[model samples]
Target: MKNIDVKSFGAVLLALTTSHCLAGEPADAGEGTVFRSLFGDTLERDYGITVSGLVDAGFSRNNNSSQRDRNSGQTNAPVAGLADENFELATMHLFIDKALKTNFVPRVTPLPGPAPSEASFGFTLEAAYGRNAQQARTYGWDMHLGINSPGDDNPDKARRDKQNFLAIPNFAGTAYLPYAGGFTVMAGVFGSGLGYEIPPNIRAARNPFASRSYAFMTESGAVSGVLLGKRLISNDSMLLGAELGVIQGQGNLRDNNDSKAVLGALRWRTPDMQTWIDYEFLVGDSQNDSTGDIQTPRGRLISRDGQFKQQHSLNGWHRFDQKWSIGGEMVYGHQEGDGKASTIDIVTGPGFDQAHWWGANMVLTYQQRKNLSLSVRAEHFDDPDGYVLFPSSTARGAFNAVTAGVRYDVNKYLTLRPELRYDWFDGQDSARPFGAGDARNQLTGTIEALVYF
Candidate 1:
């Protein structure tokens, strides 16, 4: 496994170097753009287009987990275990953007599949038009239109078997209007400006964290709404901001329902440092069907059916310097629903009325140099329901994990990252009847290479 990992990393490094060297020299380039003339007029202008992208690939191995079998597939310990080797081409993106003037510009980013297991490797364009007289005054509108085709060959099964092309057409916009009292009003659908780190979907794109473990409370699509208010105090030394929004419901596909979601957040930053604190709250009737099935964009499943869940989270991050940082987040969720017999009366459950889950994550990182760094993250989850239908044997459970990795910058355009992850699971004795006991542990190591353009 170690030999394979080294060979794979070396190959990716070679490819990235070759591509970077080629990119430095354009074919038959002799001040090409500046010399071009159109209709006796110089075509050269200060404005230009910029394009960039990245490709990441690597191999990983698992230790205590079940081996790869042709029938049961690969199992990587539900909570934490090692199983097999894997590789991925993380992201391949092309961005075309132009700055028309000091205040106006247009941009578009089209990306294809980043990994081989993806359904289809085709471009999905996200285009936008914007105007920004200054950072304090800016407005932008964007639209997305694409067709995603399924890669699976099965054509008969209805739920997870068939393969088809899905069309996506979504519109969203945003405006940041600043006022005299260090305040601003922001409004948009699917717009940016909700929090510090990017959401899970946008971060991973193709393979987002969708299982019950992450994102305790799930929403069907992007949050679409209007946010009001802004930073009460603003300066290089201190900052505070608050926002509220009324968004579309979680499972409403048509965007025509009267049900809605209300969200609020408060953020604070210390002066003269990269340290911040954020508190967020979400409440609403996020469920649609009364049946025990929850509808998601990918499909429908029965888990926390007909349950109303509320989530509260607090997060903090501190950057000691350019070379080191630490961050952590704590999240709590509570669900109210009809219990087994009670849900039977409402035709929704066989559920737990007062189900709840909570977890926390901590991360530490050190940048040894411009081209190398090391990071470690530890996380825990406590889910009373083992993602099963009501009255299952798995009553309550807890999972804990620690991941450590080192990243090396092969060059300006390429980077290699190797990581090791360990996980531990604790649950009822009857929860798992297989060879594994109530407590299980596993390990995984992955080496990834990224090439940026």
Candidate 2:
């Protein structure tokens, strides 16, 4: 008999527990409740804390695979986020949330009335056995650009080399203020405010798609920072926020440089809350070194130093009645002085100091029934410096893809999505991104199941 790996086993157990907790069913009293009731002692255990989680798994096949055993390693999808072709566990997320009592005003009150404000604390512990988990682990605490570690030099690859499960991406504390018609302050590691797509399990309703767009595929993941937000207009029609952080992205255990990143955002919505728009901008330094698996984009291992990175993005969505809606995103990002060995020649070229990339995506969804919805997405991405794409080869170019899928609610606790996607490459060299220089276009089919508890 083969001995089982203990860590993998533990991850599986955690996943199951999370799924059971978030499955959309009523919480059971269970033996603990019975014991407490029998003793007539309610430990005040259920106070203000909430626990929830999800288990996401998928079965996918990539026609571009090089062999049955090895991946093609040339697709646009980031490493671990999506495999070339396989049945995999995408993510298992467990969330714990607690709201601080708002009525506990101090004996010496500064305000005339009760402090009707509350504070909240929440954290998500994520685990994965597949490629996506391998790509999303943040290393160190708030590390910056241009530092190197000995053993696993490639930050992104290091994840592939290390554990098969476990990631803690969201650890945050939020405070609500009653001043100026109420506002919020939050600090910790959280998702970036720049992108339309986010890591799964953050929202009550999961996005109806299996894969993500190029913008999400290549953009920053999370940030270690502090943020402030407040609604400005009546009916919550307008909101503003700002973020100050250690750097632009995640994965580093410590700050590698002295500089930091700043971000600002403005959001507007209709009085009916049917249509909304957000504009966000971020400026900061991005590390050229490999920090870890969590911060890298598309599994590209960056090895330069003191690279300046900036981003501008706009995102919005509109609801046309309750059955149909549309959303879109546009983003442009640039980086310079962040190249490695292969980019030296290019960076030294005349009038070339930076690499630029831009992309746009649109998503349309239709609700077919109470438990069913359909969605389609199309996007185009451009990369001129080959910075975020083909980090090894000089594959500066563009990529285009489209996806169509359906979301079916099997039950309150289970959801399934089946999708089809196609991608085409327009690199300088025959689009030789996949292995053996033979992959320029790809067709993939995938089905994903999500269990919430």
Candidate 3:
């Protein structure tokens, strides 16, 4: 072994990694990947572009599958993710980033995150494909992409494929001005920056849970516009941050209404670095589009002219010990439009009165070992007026969920999350949205693998 060529072996490893990674997830993979190991020097050194990606897939089993058809697919109705039964061809993401000109790839990167005092300019372009892409699409902007169905012409109308979900979740440029602590301005298509969890779907999973909560599933998607953020106070111990933006409305890629939406956030990181709280909101007109393009078989399902929509949230977390931590989030959202019974998650047309919905969630996690951690979450969302959430025909009114999962780092480049989740509907007895649209409750067990390179 001492006589072997080290450099030649690395090249072989690069090629083998590329082929195996593309084909499927690796069981015990090496730290160095294809692009990062091969072009990590050239791309980052020459053009300042860092390329990274991850593939997250999972298999979920629903207890109610017996009451449903195998072809219909098992589902945890009302939850955006975890909707599929058996194997889920989850998010496959890629990122092309130029963040902080001076910082690029190296053999070993230390924990010193983005420096506060230094000014910088950068950009990010991310492409994602999977079930989550249906929620990540920039609304009107990417019509042909991220649709829920297969090709326009297919015998099985219920069939879906990765080809339908080629989505650009984020595309934006940024500039950091080194004045009064630091000011950052970002524009183009990016996130609303309002929620506790986001489907960044690049580099890695932004949230700990493999399956998202009802609050997160009902929250708005990416927006098109500009955002301005500043570090009001910054130090080694504490950091106070705030941001504001004008967008084309949450989920709406282009301007559907004559009016635009306003979104912002105020965050506080305590001196101990073990606790933080954030208050974020989005308020404005998101309706006014009558175009048939956005319609669904359920009916005109989203946005209405002159109806103003708003959502507000308060969330925080505190750590009592290195291994034990607790976090929670509260949300209140409503539209100044007539209430309506939704056949799907989004309802556009008018109904009885104004709509109102709210939700709360709590998460507790334990770091059992250096390479493994355990998490459990309890959440409830109320769509009393039959608005905000609608996963199945009978899945209306309110939603409740309990989830427990563990994350195991198999290696630097591989992660595995096996989760158990239970959900129930609190609506009409006559309508059942679970058990393949036949039962009132559902249990799903899932194992998700995240492979990064």
Candidate 4:
């Protein structure tokens, strides 16, 4: 796993970003963003507060949209927040951070370098609204779907986002101690650091295509826990870091059950910061039943159905030249004691003791020009029992996605992204998951405008 990838999301992210191919945007900030220069960098360099955000709006056309499905409010469907057929506001995002100062010598890469000569404290806050907030919602908040419901049939579920589901993906504080290497401790609700793509954000640095991968679609978006990160080894050519945390079960605002879980991550990168890899995992009973009553996505609390699971992944990226790069990720998950979910109730008995799924994808990018880049991604996901993607369908086997996209920098504070993608399934025939369950495959075309401020 160490020999394969660069990376995305999770613990070490409070640190600066490594130079990835999708990296030159205002989000990277070092190349310079509106907010970074708004106060002439004084906000970060003097007051220590940095602000950044964007407004994302787009239109999508799906080849599978039918009159019947459109009337029912389901189209190419729930693959992210992009499950709609016309013009829509995807999200309005805001990020504010007071960076912690570490005692290590700063490198030339990664922008907005904080004062690294001393040990200090800092905090981060993020708020997002629009269709994308649906997935960012916690199990016991924002949303209301539960385990025993037939399915999510809210009617309003697919068309647009209401004002009620606003999400704060991160509200955490950290302290950096200039000790052996460096010790950073953080607490509060933070974004999940386990995948190659950031949670629920189509604008994530790893997802230049503006569309998510199957590997990132259904993982928990946030966890109310504490994370500890440390730089173990730092040198001119290479660096290593580690993190550990304890938290409430996945997507819970408060205690949904009596048990908590443990998660840890390890990362290694080069000083040049062009190549890196990450490995991380979470182990615990994120469900109800043994510890307490089960709480559904809708905040409905009921008796447990024996839900215990594990989610793990390994991902990374590498730059081969000024204009070429590649990145890849492998994801695996296991669930035990989970009852089959249905409209009526959670089913338990024989033939439902455990479920497992795994998937992988590779991304290749070419900097066609200084202001325009092209990317192609190929991925496959398998879930025989539909554990993670339960609400999508019950069909099993291998699911695949192919995507090609273009990123044109209209300017420093704006980008235009146009993408085309195809998704299909093989194996089970009992259910159809796309085009509102009427098609085995779907093709979608989308173009978005991201205006940074």
Candidate 5:
């Protein structure tokens, strides 16, 4: 008798499930001479696991003295908040995953329906590092512990932590169950079901801009939760999901507050797969787990817990023709309390007001050639209460931005994108958000390269 390892066993099981055994063998070939002859080397072969990754790096130059703080060399610029004119590693991600089988048999048939499909189970582990990782990392621990500083005037080198160096953004397992038609269950940190623009890693992720919108920045990110989804129609065009999780904004494994969040989403796609839409709603606490010491509306920063937050978003994209496509997103988000009162701690009592913001953006893309594409985006966000944007400033107004870019695929593994963007601060009486406090608008030019396996 011989002992078998997990990888070798996995390969054997896959071959058996796929009915890919050697040909010219008896149906009941327990004495399998041909199988042994053809796959004698299979016992040493790697299983179905796959390895893929992406490298996103770029140089960005700003026009308004770069708006970078002279003392800290940090800018409040939008997406690629690089130091004025410098090259930066925007983001890098490595993924190890396996495709799960898609057929599952029901334990017990409760109703008459289509035949059960085979069951599949798979997992994904992904790690990311770079500036984008800094932006997407969980906010509370990273910010409070000084692990990351997005717009800090003075950064502490010693306190800079591993959250920005090597962050495990996603580790999820997926399983399929043949219940009513079928159900897919995912556990662990998963990308937000909202947003038309996903984290840019590969071409298939569908993020056309190097700079992101204000809505995308504030609405959602990788969430630590359990998600269950099912197809509601036979065409496989409609999907509905329910998510229960630790709350939004924070991506760490632990929940910050006693309050939990519930999220619901609906996704629809056309039969041709050219048009798709997704809507998601979430309500939960946005505060951290601070038990003591919070800020108030008063000039002094004190100790007080914060209230719950609510957010909803709709994102969709449509292909008008072979060469043209359009995408749009709308987001509405609100948090309870003013700047000082919005503590990271959980608050059960109501002593604050609601700060809200709503924003929408439209994206147009044209495939000029097989390897060349162009995209333009226009977005507007209104923060009348100065809630979601500049919390400390007395500014209350809207922000608008326009962006145009082109993507040129040099090859299957490499792409180059160059873009120009302009942002305007509308109806603000105080400090400007983009520049060095003296300007209301800023202009920037950026180019990035994405290399993937």
Candidate 6:
């Protein structure tokens, strides 16, 4: 709700840049020696330090695609051209960890090696620091800091600014859970647990079907207060878990209002099957409103009188065998706003809810080997408010798409993926396409690479 002066904001950006540069140096030094230590059995005695990263560079040709040129150019149908491209950066990450043995802490009495079992505190100070290249280009630095608690088992836990698709226990130190286990309390900024694609914050590319074309839910942001509980029904087959939280509503950053949200989920898993259903309810000032008043640089922005939004999702995954798997996700959400009648045709009618939308995705994958895999995915989206595209329209549009791709494990530390996609639009006559002119069909190709250590 408050805006920082340009100078103060610039100072914060500078500090972040310096921090990222410093973090990258140490990890880069540790990368070379990590492999030697692991293979020589020295890792057991020494801390573990590893480095990994990826670089993906490739050429793509689009058919029936349109392009806009900044320089002098001639208009053409499905214009096509070729040139060297560096669409995405391949990264190499370095990690360093020190493992303090289980008995390092002293027990109440005293036992062997380090301390007594009962009194001993089994813990490890796992600190992670890294810098990314994208940060260098955009923010002048990519600095990260992470610390994990002792005996923490969930590796997929959420992280600050990191987005995750499934709702699971939080292992990342950033999560604001009151307690770690059984009737836990958590609060902080965490990813939305709906949607099939990886949370958008950490995504390497855009999610084709997200409501906002360039906005990934992961990057949507969060500021939350939560309470969670989990009950294990069976050793491995059933589990019931629930989470309730009040989100800050002002996107992912700090703000002064109590825009609240509640979420709950139930999960079941076996060797061959897994399924989950989640519900989310959001009530508060519209994302466009904060502090009961909408303030903008130019003047006071009007707040919609009865604006509210809600979303729901269901997801499941099944492993048919060691080599094949199938999964699907469905999500729907609606936004309603009340305001004075508007003469503008694009605006929802008088006191009308402006946006109603729903969509879903399904994917099937096959692992040909340890180093290779293939996947096919389909997605559909409908936006009645025309929120996804500019020139918000009164006529709703629907979009459907299909994508196929292959992932190759270039090595233990690197992976490369190449994909091709096609998209189609329903009600072509009712809405304009993404590019200029009247086109309804589109195609795209991409190659991505990932590296981890």
RMSD of each: 11.3, 7.4, 7.5, 9.1, 11.4, 13.1
- lDDT-better candidate, 1 vs 4: 4
> lDDT tens digits, residues 205-244, model 1?
2111111223332212344555454555655566666667
lDDT of 3: 0.65
Ranked candidates (TM-score, high to low): 3, 4, 5, 2, 1, 6
lDDT of 3 by residue, 207-273 (tens): 6777888778656667778888765665676767778888877766656556788888887776565
What is the alpha-carbon lDDT for the whole of candidate 2? 0.56
Model 6 earns a TM-score of: 0.59
Candidate 2 lDDT over 1-453, as tens digits, reads 012354674466455445435554344422122233354443336554455556676667766665632333224243223453454556666665554333211100011224455444433333333335444545564222122232124544433332234455556675666676555565676656566776763323325688777677565555667766655554343323333344434443345444567766666666565776777777777643443432333223344445677787888888998799998889898776533453232233323356778999899999999789999988887876666543433456887888999998665556778999887778875556543456777777888777665
- TM-score per candidate: 0.64, 0.75, 0.82, 0.81, 0.75, 0.59
Candidate 1 weakest lDDT stretch, 10 residues: 129-138
lDDT values, one for every candidate: 0.43, 0.56, 0.65, 0.66, 0.59, 0.38
Backbone clashes in candidate 4 total 9
Model 2 CA lDDT for position 207: 50
Ranking by lDDT: 4, 3, 5, 2, 1, 6
Error of 1 at 366 (Å): 1.5
Summed over model 5, clashes come to: 12
RMSD of 4: 9.1
Q: Give the Å error, residue 350, model 2.
A: 13
Number of the candidate with higher lDDT, 1 or 5: 5
For candidate 6, lDDT tens digit of each residue in 381-403? Answer: 67655553322122357767777
Query: What is the C-alpha local distance difference test score of candidate 5?
Result: 0.59
**At residue 401, what lDDT does model 4 achieve?**
90
Q: Stretches of candidate 3 above 4 Å error? A: 1-32, 46-48, 101-118, 145-164, 201-206, 235-237, 291-305, 338-352, 391-394
